[model samples]
Target chain A: MNAVKKIVKAREFTSFLFLAGLFLVVGIINPAFLSVDNISACFNSSMVYTLIAVGMAFAIFIGEIDVSVGSTMGLSAAVAGTMIQNGSNWFLAFAVGILIGVVVGLVNGWGVAVMKIPSLIFTLGTNGILRGMMYLQVGVEQVNSLPKEFKDMSSKTLVGRFTVYYCCAVLLTIGIHFLLTRTKRGRYFIAVGDNAGGAELVGIPATRTKVTAYLICGVLSAAAGIIFASRIGIVTSLSGNGYEMKAVAACVLGGISLSGGVGSVIGAGIGAVIMASISYLLVFMEAPSNYDNAITGVILITIVVVDALMQHRAAVNNRHARLAARTSAVPGGKEGLEQ
Target chain B: MSDKTPKLGGQNGLRRLWNGPNFRWNLFLLLLITVECVVFGATNSKFLSLTRIFASANGDLTFWYVSIFVTFVMITGGIDIQSCSIVGLTSIIIGVAWQDFGMNIWAAAALAVAVSVACGALSGFFVAYCGVQAMVVTLGGSFLYSGLGLLVSGLSSTEAYKGISGFPDSFKALTKTKIFDLIPLQMIIFLVLLLAAYLLLHRSKYGRKVFLVGVNPSAAEYSGVNSRWITMSTYILSGLAAGITGVVMTSQLGTAKSDLGGNFTMTIITACVLGGTLSTGGKGSAIGTALAAISITLLRFGMPLCFGINKQYLDIPIGVLLVVVVVGRAIVSNPTVIAWVGKLRGKGKEAKAGA
Candidate 1:
């Protein structure tokens, strides 16, 4: 019973369990899918998704969203891809890409925190502007022929098929996750997201915290763009289109709340692997790629409904326990329960 | 029944207009439209011609149709991004029914509308009954419907990329027909739609209930209104609007595809916000949506024709305009900005006195 309680309380546990069960189920149907190389390949492909989901987790943790992450990723990829293709220094290309993302993030933060505009509409507008700029930048030609070293970096693994980029991204995400959950300043993200007014009353500088969250989200999304360019070896104007929804789905799967103040970047990373593996899984399942969006939609609805039902049942059980302990003269049970 | 109040005219009427709740936004929209018109006309003289303006305006019949219902959803404090998907779904359904199932065009249109309404009910159920977030559910719904649209296209044995063309000439004439060689039929259709939406949204008892539900659903429920039912009904209404838009777009394009009205989600939402429909809900008008749609349509046309902008890049100005307008509105409404204006005025007065 205590084990059940612990598992229930640990939100990320379900996500990890789901991830394992997913791989098991698919592996059962196709034994080849269980191979270490194939599975590790899934992790490698999930690097961009993991990055964006972690970034999105930061924004969602702070009780907001940035739909422009897709466009930010796209614009970054386009600009960086262009520079790299044109023989520009790799560092310069990455700097320009990240600079654009920072500018977009600051604008979004100003609109959302300082100017008091809704994050959805603000980021949506940025999405449009960035996508359009990407279109203008890459007219009639995709950016190709990135440097050999950068292109090879995605597959260059020291021990096993795990790419250095995915490893680094995972480690960075875990580090940030610890900082967010364990540090004093890190708690502000949750405090502000949980209740900005209450957080302000307690002197948390809710607006600054929210702004910082957006900045971090921006930086991470820009980093994902850099990784995407390196991994894909090319960038079309529409390279990252519709990726925002995938990231959002990953966050939800990872146990992050859309309404904010819950979940972890580690969970988002796991969820990203699950989400990014769907198209690859399709090959083994012999299903057409057209089912990709539908499958994602079904998974999203299923997990959310399951989560909601579990929460509801837990609430009901808690209420019954409290009532039973209070009204019924259960001395020890009542005393041992939380106040 | 108390009809004895004296009619106010001229200055009094102007005063009433100024004091009205949506007056500033409405006036701002009007001035902005006029300024856009003048600026575009200055850039290209051909843009100012009335016939050309009307011709360009008639092209956005689908947007005008979608915006009216978007206003309805926005007024209720929810958004219907899935309406764009519904347009695609409805268009594909009609095409498949007509071409593959050998159904009559009109009957196929009816079936498409019914299916769209069912889609709305599904999303509405989650939002109203399950207490899920409207945006997230609709976002999911959008994906589901668009995918379903593609699946249906696959079932039709038609390659999805080819789309379903060879629409009947009569159906094509439905959108192409002009009245008296001067006025297009779409203008009249739009005007009638505007009147119907205006009456339904502003001049009806249900409209009052909708507003109350948006403003405070709990209070409305206490007052005997079924808030969930009201909310669900608005989505059905919006779905019906999307169905109409699908038919119009199909006739206009003379084809139906899974990607119909691809950019309309943003376009219509921009129209609603630009025209004065509050995103937070409970404050929008069909008239405002219409005005905004017209302005946006003109901007879409003028940007390319007058300023030589590539069609692909038009989204930049549209996005920048949306952010600027919403942020500008926020600044205008902020108390600190108002106080600063007053302080600056006081400082100017003191400076004049010293001079």
Candidate 2:
């Protein structure tokens, strides 16, 4: 009974358990899987996913989803690559890339907030349009001539062990933590998600708050695109094709609900780690590489189920704990219970 | 009552246009086709040739046909992004069972449809019973089914990118063979499907129930309408349509790729919206959606052929068109414009009376 109680109380804790167990299994299958070099490689590749997931957290927190982030990322990279190829300085190129992201985010927010179009449809259209633009502008031609400094982003080792991108991930997590918990805008963002109408009643501008959330999401997504381009050392039209789904999956795994208003920065960061680790662990098991995508699908479904059950359990536990506290405090409460 | 009855007929015929179930928006479709013909002909004389038009129409018809079914799904306030993945899976299942395993083609097709319908029902169950939002459930579904499609393709001898070919001649005939030796068999199939959908969505009792359910499920429930069944059935119908379209597409292309129907979710949803189906639900038309699909299919093939522009840039025009139509609708609703137009007409009438 106590074991059952323990399991119900610790949801994310259980996810951590499952994630660790996966690594253990992989280590047993192939001892090389636990090697520092391979682990470092996983973190390096995952830095992009982590960046996008954190940005997506803000949008999901504000009761919206940006399916166009993947395309926005792709579009930004294309813009950056094209500008750089045209002899623009790297800084100016990066700025142009980030600007494209902001423009796409603003259009999305306008459609949703001002025009009152549903986010699902509006984002779907934008995703298609932006993706088409990326393909047209960049074609399938890979950009391979990036400056050495940019390419060094993923290659640099920090403290003689961890990759520079991993350090960036840590810094991003801390920054997001400060932005989400310590800031006034972050509180209003949460308030809007929790109940938009109630927040509006209390004088919060829900539309502007939602729009700002998307703007931050857009900027971060573009930054992730830049990192991905640097890591790969080339830009392809396919670069950001499936990434939006991956980022969303990571956020969901990290305890972010699609309905919004609930999640944590640290939890989402861990979620990114868990997902990136899954791919590495599977490869080590000598499992057919083809099964990796299927495994991702299965894991995503399982996580959502577990999250739902955990939410249900938490609700029940809080009710029970409140009842116990009330009974203990009230005079004759014990007598009433006995009767 | 008699006085009001006279007034009804005394009003201008144009006044009834807005109140009519099928209005000028429907008529606007014909104008677009005429404009397309004239523009394309002027730009490229070859565009008016029979073979070019037929080839383009044949290749694009299946997608538009399938999108017509999505119009129903959208009307019920549900989306089925998984339909794209389902199309791939169905085609592969048909290909493997019939071609590789040497099973009966009809039986394989039926099994494929069953698989698709079952997948749709699973999505519906999540939405109806578990209280999950339809968009999230379908988005997850798109990932799951697409992954499943790749796995199924891997099981077959055909490479994932190369796709499955060598389908039976009769199956190919489903898409390529002509009805009157002129119209492609697929277009005929599309027309028949459109007619069926038109009757199902407009003339049937259940159709009315679907609109009610979408408009207000709680109120519908109180009215003793089985909103759950209505919602679930739309998904099943959507699945069936996707499955059939998958079979037709595979036949038409002479191959089955896991990504064959990839990127269709956006196109179908766009077609639905371009037809003026409210994304929030309770307002849609099969006829309007079908016309929109036709327009889109023509635009995709016609623009590049006429202008000699890259096909990839076509998304710009389509996106701009969608925004324009939506914004135009909003502008039409402004009271100031309507009143100003009315005053101008009234002043003109007074001058005519003086004359």
Candidate 3:
């Protein structure tokens, strides 16, 4: 019972429970969706979102926002696709893709952290610049015929039915989760986000931590771009458009506060799985895909409201518990109060 | 960060006024606009003609109208990127209601405004009451509303790409109608909106409440200001403004589409920031936003016409301008940085004197 309570009390655990409940509810509606193959498929489909959400978690953890991730992903994916399609070395193409993310991340960090510009405006500017560069890079032509090895990454299976890409992403997320929760440097992000001035006073390098957070965010987003290209097998101009919002939604669904420093990437990964599964769930329920965006919105609002209400309830309960314990400790105080 | 400033002695009030951030930014924009006109006009004489300038400026009026309202949201330290999506939603609502539901154009517009306001309320509820971050909630709103617009598009007989057209001749003339056979009608509408925005933001009690919330919400709460309602109201106002822009844009373009005004958020934001509105909130002006909008509009159109730059590359300059101006504002507004720059100048002058 204590273990169960502990698991229930952990905030990220609730997100996992929500994910399981969502799948269970959807499975009850369509038994076929409950099949092992279909369920693993959901996790497989979540690879891109999981990557993006994890990347965004770094920024959120550091108490900043990065709207530029979508564009960074797009530009990297386009560059990678173009290079591979042009018969360039795949390894070098991947490196260049990641390098693009690093540069964009550095610029974003410089603007927001070093320059003290608002994160939204600074990232929005970078978003525009990167998107424009993407358009110029892949002008009016779809980059197709990516190397078979790369394109097949999504389909490559792991132990049992899990796909290779998702397996890698899950492990990477778990590894990052440990790094965040257990390491000193990793905790710096949470410390800075919790209270920047307080952290600075405590000998934490707040600015450096924020910039490092952004750099990690950028690199992760670039990696997601490569994975996205592999899965889609074609790079269109609109390939990664509006994805930053989805990633944000996923992180929020995972119980990551936009205010920062409150949730784990593990929760984010779970939330990504939930977010990525919604469209599939809609398909199972025979709803038009056009409803996907509205459903996501509804889900986002509902989850946040529920979380807020839960917090409110918890505070009330704690107060009542404190009163009860105080009365009990006073021996006859409860009986005397009645008199 | 404080409201206090050292007063200059000997009636240097004018110089002190010039040192004020808002005044300085506006003056910079004024000078920039003037320089742009001369350079572009010198390159192409057609650009110098007053008639041509206003005529070219007509399309940008839609962007300027929306930027004013967005400036209000920013002044509260909250952003409404969803405004662009609201434009699409309103346009689609107007189209669907009038064409599909057999409603009158006027009634359809009212319906659009009401719905857009409701969308604003929905997003505002989360940000204001639930404590959700404004950016995240609005980004979700952007998705939900745009998706709703597309869903509405699915209902129209016209294919999505084809868009709905065939408006009454009067409706098409709404924006193009020449005022006194000389001035464009868009100019008149923009001026009216600008004036109204100026009074609402700078001359009203509610405006003070907005600044209070933006500067410090906890402080505002302590002072009995309902910061939640104020934040919510700004978003609602932004939505109504977006609705108006939608009607104007649809009229001006002579058609309605689900994707209309799809990418105008960047331009609106650029205008607001360039207009000297601090993204951190508590400082912005309608006139400044208007001037910034015009400067950007001129830069975008004039560059293509004068230098033969491709229209598609315009984002580069706008993006660069937003970053540069914003960073410059940050540096200039910091007293320590200003003192450093002054010290450097002092050392330079002393070295020159010794030489």
Per-candidate iRMSD? 1.4, 2.3, 1.6
Give the winner by lDDT. Answer: 3
Q: Best candidate per DockQ, number? A: 1
lDDT of model number 3:
0.86
Q: Write the per-residue lDDT of candidate 1 for residues B13-98, one digit (tens) a residue.
A: 67766876667777777887899999999999999887787777766666788888778878888888788888888999999999
Pairwise TM-score winner, candidates 1 and 2: 1
In the predicted model 3, the residue pairs found to clash are: none
Candidate 3 wrong stretches, greater than 4 Å: A1-4, A312-339, B1-21, B49-62, B342-355
Candidate 2 wrongly placed segments (more than 4 Å)? A1-18, A28-31, A85-87, A274-278, A305-339, B1-18, B21-24, B330-355
lDDT (tens digit, per residue) of candidate 3 on A1-339: 999897688788988888888889988888878888888988899998999899999999888889888989998999998998889998999999999989988999988888888888888788878877887887778888888988987799997789988999999999999898899998999988888889999999998999988998899899999989999999877678878888888999999987777899998899899889989888988788888887887788778877877777889999988987888789898887667
How far does residue B179 in candidate 3 sit from its true spot (Å)?
Answer: 1.3
TM-score of chain A of each: 0.92, 0.87, 0.92
State the C-alpha lDDT per candidate: 0.85, 0.78, 0.86
Instruction: List TM-scores of chain B, every candidate.
Output: 0.91, 0.90, 0.90
How many angstroms is residue A202 displaced in model 2 relative to the true structure, after the best TM-score fit? 0.9
- Per-residue CA lDDT of candidate 3, range B1-355, in tens? 1223445553476666677547777888999999999999999987877787787786676578889988888888898888888888889888988999999888888899898888888888887887767887887788788889889988998887788888888777887789788888888888899998888887798888988888999999999999999999889988888888888888887788877866787788889988988788888888899999999999887888899876766777788888888887788878898899999999999999999
True contacts recovered per prediction: 0.47, 0.27, 0.52
Q: What TM-score would you give candidate 2 relative to the actual structure? A: 0.88
lDDT by residue for model 2 (B21-43), tens: 54567678767777888888888
